[model samples]
Each structure stands twice: as structure tokens, then as C-alpha cells.
Target: MFHAVAKGTPYSWANRYCYTGMFCWWGSTTYRRANSPGAAVDTGWGLKFFE
Candidate 1:
């Protein structure tokens, strides 16, 4: 499993790092310009599976 977070809605910068095995795992984060639109920042996380 993986997780992530962002700073702004109209994000300006973002990044993530992950690893995999029977299941996939990752970590991520994001940033946005001081002045932007939408919701101030955006963020998300996900998981992956391998056979």
C-alpha cells in the first residue's frame, strides 16, 4: 500500500517514491503555488499488486 498528500488544489510541484513486492507500496507528496485555484492543493495514494 502507498500514501500521498499535496499542498494545493492547482498543485505546482509533486513527488513520490515507491517499492514493490507481492504488493506494491509507495509514499508521495505535493506542493502548490502560494496563489492558485481549485482547492488549495491536491493529494492521493494507491496500492499495486504483482503476480
Candidate 2:
């Protein structure tokens, strides 16, 4: 997360690093562009780090 802050992370940037099992035990992501007119993706789930 610190890397995102340092690089002025863009919207949906983190989505690329997203994985089914990552460094976290459970995680989620939401997509939305600031000041943009469109529907934001609200799909997220509590997945495990290892399947």
C-alpha cells in the first residue's frame, strides 16, 4: 500500500496485482474513477490466501 501512495497510484491500479491467493488471508477490491460518471464495481468477497 505504501508503494501505491508513493507512486500516486491511479484508480484501478491495484487491480493488476490482484490474485486469488495473495499475501493476505482475505482481501477485496472495488473499482471507481474519481469525478467520473459511471457505475462503480461493487463486487468483492472474503477469499483465503491459499485455496
Candidate 3:
């Protein structure tokens, strides 16, 4: 989870989570494993996955 990855509230970890969330939201679709059905939508725009 984001909380676990952001141990000690590290800046880099937080940034990575933010970026990954963005990528999953804009790159991966609702049907993809990365984006579940109940999860956020993906725009598939100028985003690069895992970025």
C-alpha cells in the first residue's frame, strides 16, 4: 500500500506513489489488473506506466 511504501514519510516514496497512481489512472484501463473495476479511470493520454 501507499502507506507502507512511504515509510518514514519519505519524499521520494511519496512522489513515486503519486506518479504511479497517475500512471495507473491515465494509462491502465479499468479492465487491466493494474486498474480494478471499482478503481479510478484511465485516460490513456500522455502518461507512461510506472512513471
- Candidate 1 accuracy as lDDT: 0.48
Model 2 alpha-carbon miss at residue 23, Å: 12
List the candidate 2 regions with Cα displacement exceeding 4 Å. 1-6, 9-28, 44-51
lDDT of 3: 0.41
47: Cα error in model 1, Å: 0.8
Sort all candidates by TM-score, best to worst: 1, 2, 3
Q: Global CA lDDT of candidate 2, please?
A: 0.45
Model 3: pairs clashing at backbone N, Cα or C within 3 Å: none
Better model by lDDT: candidate 2 vs candidate 3:
2
Predictions in order: lDDT: 0.48, 0.45, 0.41
Q: Of models 1 and 2, which has the larger TM-score?
A: 1
The TM-scores of all predictions, comma-separated, are 0.23, 0.21, 0.14
lDDT of 3 by residue, 1-51 (tens): 132234456566444543233334354423334545654544344433442
Score residue 51 of candidate 2 by CA lDDT. 21
